[model samples]
Target: MIPLLASLLLVTTRPAVSQVILVEKAYEYVQKKEFGKAREAIDLAAANESTALDARTWYLRGYIYKELYKANPATGGELRAAALEYLGKSAQLDTSLAYRKDGQAVTRYLVVTFYNEASGDLNRQAFDKALTGFRNYLQARSGEPPDNAYATALYYAGYTSLLMGNQSGARQYYEQALRLNYRNSSLYSDLTSIYEAAGQDSLAAGTIRAGRQQFPGDTVLRITEINLLLSQKNYRRVEAIVEEYLALYPANVEVMLVAGTVYERISQGDSLSRESYFNKRKEIYRRVLSTYPDNFSANYNLGITLYNRAVDLIKAQQYDLDIVLLYEILEKVSGLFREAKPYVEKAYRLSPGNLNAMRALEGIYYNLNEKEKSRQIRATINEMK
Candidate 1:
């Protein structure tokens, strides 16, 4: 019983006395301006089990570190980070509220220091350093009241993370900033890109949906969600989503373009009713051309749609045996080519170097018996080669 009591007493008293001595040594080193030695002593005291749980020990350690941070003329970040970290610990562990104001002051100083650093680094385009600085500022002020600056800093962290090719980190920072209601519409697009790049299609779609809710009528996200559905080959779902968007924005060029492309894809793929699919494609681009007359894609697509219909009609005539019916079909096929001529010509005029439009124009002019126009288009196409 005597041995056990002595061992327990030694275990209790040794660390207690050591902590007191270490604290005294830390203060002495500070008075001598030996901050490195002071840091060492306080770090050992901080690690000792007896002193580790004591708020007073952490408080003194924090105060000493703060002084060391101030004494250093170097912009070496380690000392300031250590000061804020220890002070935060001291403040958190101090249930009596003692030293709370001092801890708060140290945290504020760290925040301001980092904020200035981040601003300068950003101006210099030192993205990694800027991100770290903003992150440090936010972390120092964590658990404090958040404001606009805090939210903007979070977004900058995510933006830098993205630029540095850290998609997962970018996602985390963006999600946090969004939860705080950071109002940047481009955030959704970039975050969606990150998730989509990682093959997280469901999460990408969900992010677009959430961003749409936060920023109503954002066409980029709407288009993104539609493209996501299209990528999955969920044509019916894509159609439904595209229709929903078109209802909201009837004159939306991008949505119309996507819708036209989707229908054209199905027509070229496995659709049973190719005529109806082609008709849908033609109608969408026609509406787009009516609204945006010089629209390159719409003009080109409408021309191609008409050209394909004419080709289908000619192919049908070859499958027939009746001479009179073949003649009538041939006449209609020529008329279809004539109908396609203007749109293809418009497309080529709007975008002079477009190979597809030139090719279509060459085909239309040749089929319509305009040898000179066809020859000129063929020479231009050869030059492109």
Candidate 2:
């Protein structure tokens, strides 16, 4: 009777001991490289309420799955998630030295995996995925010493978000990197774009100025700043900014182009003296042309500006003028057309088949009494397929 009763007690105790026994068996299976059985054993160990809170159970679970994740990150799926979660939990519980070491190793592998995935996504132009992957790498190794790749990762994270059309996300990630003192010139250039797109004109201007402070010789940011100021109709400030840059970088084609654009914007607005702004825009383009003789934009914009100025001047002449006076006014206006002709002609030479350049040349040649040239320009325009 006593022996039978003892056997019954042992049978009831089996369920109670099942959790740790399964966990130990999981370790055994892992040693034998039988991950399938290891997973089964760990799953059962975690399923039991009594073992659920035990540190060793979670540690063993983490260890088994960490190996699985490291085996193939792309195929890790729920196993990867399970490993990261239980490993994090084990570390949090201060399980043991072995558990902590395994957790760190898993995290290190995760860092490497995510970094590679981020770079791969970047190569494929899968920007949103790249951004997330880069961020995941940082999260994996939060307390580790940052390498040069840290800034590169952050910059790409921002760039990828920008590509995904998430301006706010780009700004957030870029700003984090900037705060960490990342020293790339494009950092400022890109941040300005985000701020400008968001309609934060002041912020955009500030970003450009800040970039200029860090990289004083970078005229791209300087031009962007001047353009932003122009958009706000800050004409004097635009003049000042452009002049400052020109003094520092004499005959710079890009800065000169931006300066011309600034005055062009000012000339179109009512706040400034249109005549002065018009002349300034012309002068700036002329300066650009002197350095870059075959520059298409300078020639085209200068021609357009002269044509518009003549139109404005002619319209301002009153109908009260006598026939001879009107004739004389038309003759004087023909001089403006003459001045604009060579610029439009040069633009046409630079871009042989450009439709806008062709159209502008036709108008200039027609107004200047070169009917044959005008006809030829129109024929070329018509030949465009």
Which candidate number has the best lDDT? 1
- lDDT (Cα) of model 1: 0.83
Q: Scored by CA lDDT, what does every candidate get?
A: 0.83, 0.82
TM-score of each: 0.57, 0.66
Q: Candidate 1, residues 1-385: lDDT per residue as tens digits? A: 5699898898879768978799789879978878789889989988988778777677777777777767762554677767767877887789999878877776687678887888788878898888888888888678778887888888888988888888888889998888888998778888888888889998888888888887888888777777777777888788888888889889889999999988876776665868898888889998998889999889888888889889887766555468988888888888888888889899999999999999989988889899999999999899989
Residue ranges of candidate 2 with Cα displaced over 4 Å: 1-79, 119-124, 134-159, 168-211, 265-296, 320-385
Q: Candidate 1, clashing residue pairs?
A: none
- Itemize residue pairs with steric clashes in candidate 2: none
Query: Candidate 2 lDDT, tens digit per residue, 52-165?
Result: 877777877887887887787777856766877888777777645656776677656656778788899899998877888888877766767766677777888888888888
On a 0 to 1 TM-score scale, where does candidate 2 land against the true structure? Answer: 0.66
Q: How well does model 2 score by local distance difference test?
A: 0.82
